[model samples]
Target: MGAGGDAEEGVELEAVREDEPMTDLDMSRACVESCVRFREGTLKSSHVFASVSCPILHKLEEALFCFTANTTEDASILSSKNATPVVLPFLVRFVDFDNKVFLEFHQIMTDRKFRTGKQLCTEGKLEEGLKLMKEAVDINPTKAEFRGHRAYWLQENGQFDEAKKEALTVLIKLNPSYLMAYQVYYNSCLLTGDVRGMQDAILRMKSCPGRVTKSRCKIEENEQILMILKEFCVRLTDLEKTKNFYEILKICKEALKIAPYSNEILVKKGIALFGLKRFAESVEAFKEIPSYSTSFRLLDIMSKAEYLSLKFPPAMEYNRQAIDLLNEAAPERKNLIKFRESMAAISEEIKEVLIAMQNKDWKSMQERAANTKNLINSGSYKNERLKLQMMNFEAGAFVQQKKLDEAFVLVNEVLSAWDTNYEALSILVDINITVGKYHDALTDLERLKGMKKGVDDQMVDRRILEAKTKQQEMKHATEPPTRFLNLYTMLKLPVGATDSEIRSQYRNLSRTYHPDKTRHLSEAEQNDANNRLLKIQTAYGILSDPGRRNNYDKGLAALESRNKTDSKNGLVIRLEENRKKYPKVFGLASSSEEGIPSGSSATPTTAPSPESTVTSKKRVQQEDGVISPDKVKRFKAN
Candidate 1:
């Protein structure tokens, strides 16, 4: 053997020598020397003296070397492999073994590995940290510290069953007094849905000595868990209060991952689905809870889902179940009376809606629907589907009353709120057609056809075709008339009438068709008379002005020239000749009076002579009270 091997073998032999009893200090010094020699590569495992001193000393030397080096990787390997399995017992039997030194060395090695694993965990390398922690527990199976660490890592990694096992081992087998172990156990119980286990852990923690005077790792962990639980509870309560169902559903789903079998979480999920009007989904969520675990709130939600799905019988059955649960509930339960009243009101409203539907009494349906909506707004009811159904019924009542404009407005609101609603769409289509909004009707019909499930396509197509046909007919009927109406035709006058004659004609027509003259007529007739009277007044106003009359005459002359090929042109010529023959009647001024305005009267210089007067009387008598045309001509000649 080499000098180094000789020296290591002699030390092992000296440790086994029974004649010289070593004190605790002597043993500690020897262990420290062995660790230094092992690091210097002088202590070889192959140079074995005996199993008793060699195995224990060899492991202790290696553990102490790793601890003194403070190499996390080497320490982890030593602890994980349980390199000191026999070291404790060997020390206990040794003459100079120091328990304090043994504990210190083990602690140093364990701490190095633990800190490394914890670093890995802090860095979000949970799987690697879990592996390291598991190795730590394997190395020191009797240390609650190592087991508690492993349990925490397991719980964090979502290995609740494994974490619970590790925590139980620490609390039950390794060290029953470890407060951190109880904390880990409680957390595991919470994650694994073991309520009783969590309560037991909490009690043990509270009963722990120095819990208040001394700060403990477990207390910090417990507070962290409490803060998390409180935050979740507050968030859920706020979501429920605000009726934010979608967000509530998401939050509940996350909560379920933490406590998969939690009845409270499942009930909250069911209620959120119900709020979203996902009745079937809500029912499925509710079904996850066992009957024995079901509460009045859960039962009520289930009943509401069935009710909204139009399964009235099942709804009623669920409501009965809820009532039974309520009756069996403790009398001191908060909100018990309020809950019972709400349930009864729901049952009553359901009956009313069903009856109204059965009788097809739209008015009654509307009233019931309105009441249900009010109940929902008042927070007595919480069914969005029911509220939508009530709105549909109210819209239908408007349709039944033939208040189509009102119906249109109401149905539009319903469709805006729930675009996929078939009844609302159908009602909207009907309203559109009734009010001559064919384009809108067609648009709604197309949308309805595209729906996954909706009104009959054939019926809708028929309505579309009818709407198209009516639209075309309306276009044709509303086209402007082909005949042209001139000013003369509008006033019912001859083409060459004088200004005075036009005025006279307008007065007669206006009186005949005046608004007051048609006051006793129907509205339509009164409107028509007013329109005609307005036209007559407008035409008279245009022709009464000289400037406008000249412009109108020019337009009329142009029109006459354009129509010269027709017989109407000959009638126009004859009317012009009659104007020339009766110049005075047509308001034509003579050449001598050209400077005088037409409306001014020409006063006679002297009164009619006595002979002229007697002659006019004789002429009127001779002509049977009518003046002769030759006598009026002779008087003008004289």
Candidate 2:
């Protein structure tokens, strides 16, 4: 049977949930954790999620209803209704988003809140846990954890197709280093009675070759990885064999010590940690993931960890980050951990500080260099681009704070990269134009045209026109042009312009400036048209013929290069070198191969096969360290 047909037999888009009561924490923390795994680039977690399409779609229908119900809130930021724990459940649902939301949603996501939200998912409320995970993913679609959980929940609920797709998307985002995603994906298929997916996963895992790590294996470490692999192999060797959670834990501990950050090893770590009783450590270990972060696993493990220790620092840290991240989350998408832990962190005074900090408006530029330096120094972001944007923000803040010199310094720093940024160029351009520096403005406009993409073309044109008008006003007006001027003007063909585009440009120019049509032209108008007509004629004459244009361009380039070289005052010295490359042609053969002298060998040997001919010929031609074909023949002849 075909793959799709076989998969059809395995399951349709059925909404099935395990009858056993899922952990209450499942919705909050687990869902968010899965999204992280998704963002971190796990595919299996996404694949397993495909199994819950019906439930996921149903949840989306509800989120849509929630979105439409709120009248005053921005469509960009949806708020949640607090009837049931919709945040966890809704977030865990499968949603379609392109793979490019990585940096765009940074302002909306918090790593801490995501962790706590996932803890709630693990508390046996599998349905609710999944929803929150799904929401976290919705807010920060770039996160791997959220997507992974969505996949896990879907697969558990029998939506394998959706789970598999989610897995693939995560893999694409994260690349193929994510073995955990594949593992979960295999489990999703295997759990749903489709053994083929598991087998396929195994095949893919093998064909890709010795784990993505550099093969710098100390024999002991290699043996340890092998041992761990063998232990995990038992899970598949006999699907019916009951696995001891402690034994699995022991195996992961040894493997982790050897390759602490290996994705495959980490995946093995997660599987083993799942069954261990020290659920908090296990959660931390899982959270310290290298690949395939399942939001479901994060939540399931997180809830268990919270139960293990409600006031743990890791859990608290999780809440804090989640709060910051959820700003961009959909309404009703709050994490329980974030909500409660954040309440604990906020005293009335701290809340006041947050409120006070929001009020800032500045018109004057910064004046202090120290203010600029201090502002830049305070930023802790590792990403270079983000650091730059934050610098801009700091500069703006300093300006509002009445630090003029600081603002200028900061703005100057920006100008270092974007010297002619309109925001910055306005400073110089306005000053130059006000002082009647028409040449400066024209020079600036000329340079601006050569800039990379995203330049404001219209703004450039306006500046150019102003510069030209100033130039005209400064110079005396020329008399009218003669009627004898050619219709074609000076032609400069664009780079890579096809023959068709060139022809079209030429035709358009030809029709516009024909002199007979300008019988009613004023003196200035006639002069302007006549000049344009001359340029058109020049352009057409130079570009219309292919050979002429090519030769002209080539010659011009050569002349320009020669002028540059001459200006540099460079020196050249010639050296005589033997031309050994033409051995026979130059009448210079090696001493050993000058002629056959006193032959030694007469027996002939069979010729080598074509593949070895080069090697055989070289072997026969050696005289001492050098190759001498004639010497070799005489030696063999004797």
Best by lDDT: 1
- Give per-residue CA lDDT, model 1, range 321-365, as digits (tens): 666665545652334345446645754674675577668887787
Q: Tell me how far candidate 2 lies from the true structure as C-alpha RMSD in angstroms.
A: 34.5
Task: Give candidate 1 regions above 4 Å deviation.
Answer: 1-243, 291-293, 328-420, 446-462, 481-638
What TM-score do all the candidates reach, one by one?
0.38, 0.23
Q: All candidates' lDDT scores?
A: 0.60, 0.44
Worst 10 residues of 2 by lDDT: 570-579
Q: Candidate 2 — number of clashing residue pairs? A: 131
